[model samples]
Target: MVLALGGLAVLALWGLDAVRIQPNRIVSGTGHGLIEALGTGPALLVMLPLALVMALAWRPTRGREALMLMLVTAMLAAMPWALSLFIGQFIDDPGGAARAAVSGASWLVGFALILMLIDLRQRLQPGALVTLVLIAVSLGSLGVAFGRGALDSLALVQEYEVRRAAFAEAIVNHLILVGVAVGASLVLALGLALWMRRVAGVRQGVLGVLSFIQTIPSLALFGLLLAPLAWLASRFPLLSDLGIQGIGWAPALLALVGYSLLPMTRNTFIALDGVDPDVIEAARGMGLAPLQVFFQVRLPLALPLLIEGIRITTVQAIGLAAVAALIGAGGLGTFIFQGLGQAAMNLVMLGALPIVLMAMLVDALLKALADAARRGDADDRTG
Candidate 1:
């Protein structure tokens, strides 16, 4: 996997278009390969890590896998600089409207490097701390790139400059929407799961309803809630004053929570119910109170799976929150839809790239937490 992905990165950097000089944002510009973008000496210099990666992949060792991880992560870190170098040297952007778009090859190189990082990390099975430091290095490098205005000539960065305030607002809104939805659904799912456990008759019906909700398309769900919410807001002016209108966050929040319920409830139910009776009995045998056994023993045992449900719900909410923009809910998706409407690809990237990064970040963080929980559980079992 390392060899294949590294080779692809090398091929893309050397063979495909690395940059384009757009006279303006709308018109297509002529493509230039890495050699043309950064010249012979620098372009060849950039390929060295990829070559090392290919060589290292030829011989597998614990040390070599770890080395490959650093190299791949360095490659990711250097990506911003690679573009910045080309932009700083090759493009003369006095007015800044002349866009130096990161064309096909550079983008592919970044993608390939990320894949190599993912592949290498899986092979190495590095601890969470190591993984997080590498991620920080990559992200920090990008932050530096932006802070220094190294990406100023780049089209996407330019778009961000135009809507910096909106971009910030979008990110905050997007996270808040996802966070609120996931949190609310978690509380609701927990209650429902407990109720279902106590009242067996409701299990099938509750699950069935949640399953049905899952089948409805997100857009349709949004539409379905629109009228009822609008009516309530009209009937009760208090609801209207509180911003519970049809075509805003109220409906979007409802739709997101609705879509989230099944996974959350199912996982919560499974986690609590799947606790070993023997373990619970052991706690009881220790002269612990029933509440203590349930809270201290069963809950701890069930935590990893409960966390798994949260991971699922949070990731799903991040993506769906983008769609909430359609109802004037205001998120990164607003830029996406507007960019599509205006035929501005850079503007779309402004909205999309952050979202993709956010999803990956949340997924990785939650997965790490779940893994830690599982490890703690295993240690307890053996000890």
Candidate 2:
């Protein structure tokens, strides 16, 4: 799959600078969007290999293989478009516009590849479904390119290049924020939870504080952090000099971390509290120290719940991160806020589409991980 995708990207690079071929119409060419320029080439390349791999991996279950292939193809096709959308957010130029179009085309290819690989039932034939979608997209692209004056009134759409840059910026920043914030939150939550379970007063106080933080509106929480953060920023000249542009990303991240704490803490407490007391006493009677008992006995029993808390927190963080745009912390939120401010529905949709998709994807992935953990636990017990 990786090889195929790399080949596709290379193929695209080969023609990256070539003038696009367009069918003549009133408009003379497709109005440049991220999908039109760069997506198709890369998507096809990426999806082909992934679909093949999935088919091989699940060959015994044709239905599953088919489904997986179809999904992989769709994802590959969507990549170019997604890349363009993100890139559009930061730059405005014909070159950038072309790149954005290429991205959309790539995503389309991914979609097609997924469809092809998956063996689908008549009722769930994603291949047919995507084919129809591709047709519509192709027609739409053509209409915009060649329909002449039909779309003249829509000419004021932001330059694809600028939109693409913005899109790229939002994606990179959001991914980084989520990765770091979630990882840190997991660690902190785990540690805090352990302490609370062992020390009753500590658990109550920490939960109370986190719950309070959760109730505070995210935007408000960011505002509340501004003064102290700024003061600290000023006191540490090096931090200020680190070229950290604004309080936006940091504060937004802090807010998310704070919000995530509650789930982790609560889940940890519940998991630990629910543990059979006899188990702990047994471990102790075996000459285990307090640390050993918690780590060797309690932690193993509590792993499922602790993981569940992480999953919940991670999903919650994804949703809340959108609000970070209010503070100039760019993400999908930028598009949403920009559209709202300008009353542009398309822009709003453009921004919101990814956030919704990303949240769903992340949630599904995490849920799968948690379920696997639980299954492993069950297997151990049975064994």
Judged by lDDT, which candidate is best?
Answer: 1
Candidate 2 structure quality by residue, lDDT tens digits, 1-383: 43344345435433433222122111223334333445877635533655455445443355654555445444444543444343444334522222212233333444444444332433345555675665455446435443432222221233222377878888888877777788888888778877886687886689889999899998899888777778877888886786343476777888888888888778877887888899899999999999999888888888777777877887788778888888877777888898788765446766777788788778777777777877987897799
lDDT of 2 at 157: 32
Per-residue lDDT of 50 in model 1: 86
Give me the overall lDDT of model 2.
Answer: 0.62
Query: Can you give the lDDT of residue 21 in candidate 1?
Result: 79
Model 1, 162-239: lDDT tens per residue?
A: 888989999999988999999999999999999998999999999999999999988888888999999999999999
Give RMSD to native, each candidate. 2.4, 12.4
TM-score of 1: 0.91
Which residue window of length 10 is worst by lDDT in model 2?
Answer: 18-27
**RMSD (Cα, Å) of model 2:** 12.4
Which candidate's TM-score is highest? 1
Clashing pairs in 1: none
Q: What is the TM-score of each candidate against the true structure?
A: 0.91, 0.58
- Write down the TM-score for model 2: 0.58
